[model samples]
Target: MEKLNWIAVDWGTSHLRVWLMDDQSKVLQHLASDRGMSSLKPEEYEATLIEMVGDALPDQGSIPVICCGMAGSRQGWAEAPYGKAPCTPPSIDAATRVSTKVSRISVFILPGIKQLPAADVMRGEETQIAGFLAENSDFDGVICLPGTHCKWVHISAGEVVSFRTFMTGELFALICGSSVLRHSVDDEGWDAEAFDAAVSDAISRPAAIAGNLFSIRAESLLSGLSAAAARSRISGLLIGIELAAARPYWLGQDVVIVGESGIASAYEVGLIQQGAMARRVTAENMTLNGLRAAHAKMVEIAQ
Candidate 1:
């Protein structure tokens, strides 16, 4: 096997994570930066990247860099294109890389995935899905990535056939932070009963959710529903709707929820209520693994 050192990056809207690997692809060191896509301009991207990886750069020709996440979006350093749905391992490998300079080092940005007219898009999660597939190559089913903007992906025969994006987390944040419900709820603490009740209400009468949202404030004014309870209600309602939308795809399929423990638990609860079997998998390192897989493929092609 040809020997090469690699730098892996998973840069998102609010944070940047970098990893250094030797020829065998074992991680040597990792670094993080707050200079994420949301805060940096195009011209400053190179300087920001070099600042994070400068000390780790190998003396050889530019270390091959593989990256995933919002770093490839329109607001990112370079506007890397999106790979449409029905993507397979080979199709992901066929994605074009974005080249940029960081002093003497060359950088390559991976393209995000998109399926148009449906208003669905993904940046960082695609790589994580790739990594998940790499490790569990035999599994074929539906993968649910829960986050600020959750993703529901269908994988079969080593390809991602179709996926959808849900704004569950974002909506939760909006309702909790800016809406009238904010005044009624506390951010800390989880109410299982309230959450379950809201999920049941939503699944049973999803159309009633919109009207009930106003009741959070109305009840607070009339019957005095606790602020925290109102907040949890809103969360349950949004997540419930997400589950309803995703039900069609997940029906009769094995479901894996890729996210941290807390969020995964919430999704699992919702899924269970809807008669779906769901499992939670840790995703902290999935992005790095996926980037490494992509970098390995690039090396093979170069050879």
Candidate 2:
């Protein structure tokens, strides 16, 4: 087995991912579990982490554990607190150390960034941005991270100058699963044409979204609209409204969508419709890179 030097963790509300790394920061092993911050208490965090990677720990010395995401939230292992925006992602100096009963590990949780004036906060996405800027140091534009809560961040001089969050993904879930449109949407087929038309409609008149959403169901029952088209349209309507609000961030700016999900692809399509060019990068790669960047900063601090 490759020698384990340290560990990297991404602990979110819904998932826990760990990477056993060598001295060179290469991943030696990858492990994950559904045990997340939402499920674990303060004391349980250490035990939960040990349960996930105890067997992989080195024998002679304590291994440094660098973590990002919700694990550092106020209710997480230990509150790493929020670093204000216009600053870089937290380095080792800003990390909150959680003393553990396990002598073999020293855990550090990196702080997330907060946009106070906008009342916006992000946990895991900050690290992704750090990792992104680590690679593309010259990049000066916006990064759109589409998920349950999408973030549109503006990067300037390698710092997160400002940002905005949109709950478009969460709204889609609630509307499609529990709202009157539930019957019109399904998990099958895709209609790019329908999606494009809905996006155009929503962009041109974002204020009509509520009425347009009901139209999906109305048209389905009256005109026999396909469930697939309805699903696509639901997604399009939500994203289109989001784009309308986030226009200042992406207008004539280089946009990069960091995610592997279908929603990421939808964002790319939505942006293209508005005459914006976008590049796609896998979320996992950006995350691991972010972890790697955090580790590098930690090393520099120790030296």
Each prediction's TM-score versus the true structure = 0.90, 0.96
lDDT of 2 by residue, 1-303 (tens): 799988999999889999999999999999999998889888889989998889988787999999999999888899998899999876668888888998999999989999878799999999999888889999999999999899999998989999999999889999989998998888889999999999999999999999999999999999999999999999999999999999999999999999867989999999999999899998988899998988888899789
The global Cα lDDT (0 to 1) of model 1 is 0.81
* Candidate 1 residue-wise lDDT, 53-155, digit = tens: 7776656677777777888788787877888777763323655455565544657777777776676888888888888888999888999998889999999
How many clashing residue pairs are found in candidate 1? Answer: 2
- Candidate 2: where is the Cα deviation over 4 Å? none
Q: How good is model 2 by TM-score?
A: 0.96
lDDT of 2 at 156: 89
Among the numbered candidates, top lDDT falls to 2
Best by TM-score: 2
RMSD for each of the candidates: 2.9, 1.3
**Candidate 2 deviation (Cα RMSD):** 1.3
- Cα-based lDDT at residue 296, candidate 2: 89
Kindly report which residue pairs in candidate 2 clash with one another: none
Model 2, CA-based lDDT: 0.92
Model 1 regions more than 4 Å off? 1-4, 89-99, 116-119, 222-224
